[model samples]
Target: MAVNLAHFALNADDIPTSRAFYEKVFGWSFVPWGPPGFYHIRTGAEDAPVQGALQQRRELIAGRRTIAPECTFTVEDVEATARAVVAAGGRILMDRFTISGVGHLIFFEDPAGNAIGAMQSDADAE
Candidate 1:
């Protein structure tokens, strides 16, 4: 038998802010899943990709803020993707580097200053 995980939620200090950061960083979409303050974020993949997330926490109260970098993102192609993220207004937090036998990786800050990562599989690094 096989099991699949649908979505993951992070405690965001500010949902809208987190949403905007993620959307800009990963090109995802967010939708409501509950009351006014509760929401779901969907990460996009594979050209017209779809994903989902549920969120709730002590952040974002219509002007007040509490969100921070809350996740990790992996990509098969890191070089081009890093360039694209920058072109779209995001900043790479670190230069790409090898991680022992893991492969090449880089960390970046989203438009909202949330830390995120991008990686290239070992097979693709060669």
Candidate 2:
């Protein structure tokens, strides 16, 4: 049996800001896909569940919007990943948090100022 990660999403406070950030930093391109909160961004064919949209958030985002927006990435170690993020000049929003007892996670911003996250299962050791 084959299993894989596919078709995931990330929320953007403002399409324009997120779009430009991704383009400049990650070289990802965005194209209109569905409705107002929909976009198709160019991404790698790796395990990344793909960014379907950077839609406008209705929650507080970087003092911009007010949407509980988040982007999830498969990581080996949440703490190590977070540490690497800080070493690379990325700011960690929260130290480490839990969600529904599923796993541990942390949020951070990209070089272009786009917020993203890294997550690891609860079974993962520190």
Candidate 3:
């Protein structure tokens, strides 16, 4: 099972404000990507720089705000991982969905209620 933390995203109520804060504090670069109000984050690291994003906030589970940064792990199989989450006492917050060029992805909350994501990368996905 591939469990590498592949990506991290900050869910912000104010994208512009959050973008500026991160930029001023960390010197990270933000590039508009994907949909409107979403930006890809780039940390100027010489070593292993992880991918990140800044996007408009949304409820992970009905009426519950995602207050913490959610991270996604690279998995070999999204569906299998989702099943494992349920069996391990976690709840699925979002079902599998295709992200076009990205892959099949799913969102779930851990036993402690931390929102997480898992993705089976497939560049050819559509």
Q: Which candidate is the best by lDDT?
A: 3
Could you tell me the lDDT of residue 71 within candidate 1?
49
How large is the C-alpha RMSD of every model relative to the true structure? Answer: 12.2, 9.3, 1.4
lDDT of each: 0.62, 0.67, 0.91
Per-model TM values vs. the true structure: 0.42, 0.49, 0.93
Candidate ranking under TM-score, highest first, comes to 3, 2, 1
**Which RMSD does model 2 reach against the true structure?**
9.3
List of clashing residue pairs for candidate 2: 58-66, 58-67, 59-65, 59-66, 59-67, 60-65, 60-66, 60-67
Question: In candidate 3, where is summed lDDT lowest over 10 consecutive residues?
Answer: 42-51
Model 1, residue 12: distance off in Å is: 18
In the range 39-75, model 1's lDDT, one tens digit per residue, is 6666565585443554656432334343542344567
> Top TM-score: which candidate number?
3
Model 3 agreement with the true structure over 1-126: per-residue lDDT tens digits: 548988999999999999999999998999999899999999747597888999999898888988889899999999999999999999999999999999999999898878899999999999
- Tell me how candidate 2 scores on lDDT: 0.67
